[model samples]
Target: MPERKPRADALRNRESVLAAADALFARCDSPESVTMADIAAAAGVGKATLFRGFGDRTGLIHALFEMRLAPIRLAAEEGPPPLGPATPPHRRIPALLDAVLCFKIDNRHLALALEGTGGGSPYAAEHYERWHSTLQEALEHLPGPADSAFTAHALLAATRADLVEHLLGQQRMTRDQLRSDLKAYTARVLGSPASVD
Candidate 1:
């Protein structure tokens, strides 16, 4: 076992590095360009310490997912109230999309980096499954005969980071416009009329 003092210091250093990387990556739009030296400098640590904390770039990426995405997975699992007969489908549907959109916005760079590589992570899979399950449950509440599984897949595919980047960065769609269009598309795909309530 490692000494408590050294372990504690290592943990603190790791947190600092990750926090700096997350912020820088979010701002810069390209995590790959942010090197270990950049992260170490940002964290006020030596590059050696950064390397020690995470063995290599891939390890750092894995750690990022663990530190960032894990909580989202847990929250989506246990934090939100499950969709049921009592919950209105329109509200729940928009809420689900909003949660996903917020996540993409927050984790934009990390998500883009992860997608650039073909390898899939377990956390990504868990996210997709959670999204599909939550959406499927919400769709069940709606008055429709659409295949819930396919609909969930389509919804997620349409809301990917690449699409968001294109819409915001290239197409220059305003946030309000994106949200409005997403809501309309979701309602139409589910075969549900817009709610006035």
Candidate 2:
């Protein structure tokens, strides 16, 4: 007998589940508050279906985050200046960090949920490796004595979703203020004091 692919209805259910989860995460104060049962209810699917589709809450959050990040990934890989490979490392680094900060700001709840304890260490994620590798390679081209690898890690760390949430929520830092601070801080790290514009 031939292997059977999942039914069309199953595929539809999976997408619906992910969409429902996204909505729930967006509205909730914390990712922990959005339970699988809540998502299953929202999607009109059974708990079993939700688990079968995503394995667990963490898996579901990871999938949703990947979907949201797809466009940004594409832009970074091939879009115009500041983000694309065609841009110089000095400029590209700040652009990349700024993009990351903006993304986190725009998707605070989802970003928070995805980076939450259930989602595990961001450092362990594949996307983190890609971002780190890109930044590390860029740092290598700079004239500083900074360890490219370590510097990349430190740079990315500055944009961690939890830290962003703390700054925005608890610290009450406005978006522009946060962006300027990050740009200035990134410039200092790169030994380019004049690039803080």
Candidate 3:
């Protein structure tokens, strides 16, 4: 059997569909609000083609979230070197928080879409759990007592979706402020000698 290449026009249509979905998903209250018709109209494609490109609306949202989160995953995995005894806790801890804050700010819409409403799917839970574990691993390497795990959990809660949303929407704090405060609080919880005050 030979690999079949997609037709040039099909490729273009797929790109158009993805672009439309990205734009609509950002503004829609829920992923369900982004109908196939809306996407087809936005992309200048027929409804049938939209379905052909992305099976269903959930599939489209999944692809959109995956596309937006790829860079974040890479940054979390490789952006800052893992915390270690040789690494200063103040420096490495702040870097980790900054990385997550940046990711949340950059992908706010996609993250909201995935985990905001509709009771949230299993995918969102899995994503959050993975992040929690990654953060715990970083905290484990910090020069702290055996109870660093609890401290890590507390820090993660402070940097969670609800906190970020409140900081941005209600408190009107700049993204930099949230990132700074999170890092500062995390340092305090970890007992880092460098104080932000």
Candidate 4:
């Protein structure tokens, strides 16, 4: 059976909820502090609407995270060089990591909130799994016998939200400095062109 599209108002309410939730998370000191009631109040909808649309707090967070990550994912899936599949593995590998790192850096708070929902292990999250699979696929394209799965996990570990937050929030590392460090680390692992530095 064909699925029915959501009503226009329902869709609008969903967008409203996402935007409201995003603002609250961005402005709040902590992600957990932002609740469904807050989101519903901000969106001008009832808590029931939020629960009906998103199932729960975690689901809503995941949806919002995916929405924010759409642009980056689209670039990797179909966009141009350095991020798209057509690019060479070595270059693409680092580019993807750079993108993920930048995204987490840019949206650290929200990312941390989403990561926190992954049962205390960020690796268990669907978002993390998608990145892991993407990086692992890119890693496999390089020449050599490196274990792509392990290598991908190791590389991704450098960009986890908690670490990024600690480095940028508490450790006071500059954005450029963190990116440079990640680039260098990735280069050494892939023995790719970035390793020349």
- Tell me, by TM-score, which candidate is best: 4
The CA lDDT of each predicted structure is: 0.71, 0.87, 0.68, 0.91
Better of 2 and 4 by TM-score: 4
Model 3 steric clash pairs: none
Q: Per-residue lDDT for 57-136 in model 4, tens only?
A: 99999999999999999999899998998998888888999999999998888999999998888889998898899989
TM-score of each: 0.75, 0.91, 0.71, 0.95
- Candidate 2, residues 44-119, lDDT tens digits: the string is 9999998888898878888888898888788888888889878888899999999989988988887777767443
- For candidate 4, give the lDDT of residue 8: 100
The CA lDDT at 176 in model 1 is 71
- Report residue 73 deviation for candidate 2 (angstroms): 0.9
Residue range 127-159, candidate 3, lDDT tens digits: 666666766776777667476666666766776
Model 2 spans with C-alpha error above 4 angstroms: 1-6, 117-120, 194-197
Question: TM-score of predicted model 3?
Answer: 0.71
Q: After superposition, how far is residue 76 of candidate 3 from its true place, in Å?
A: 2.7
Give candidate 1's whole-model lDDT.
0.71
Report the candidate with higher TM-score, 2 versus 3. Answer: 2
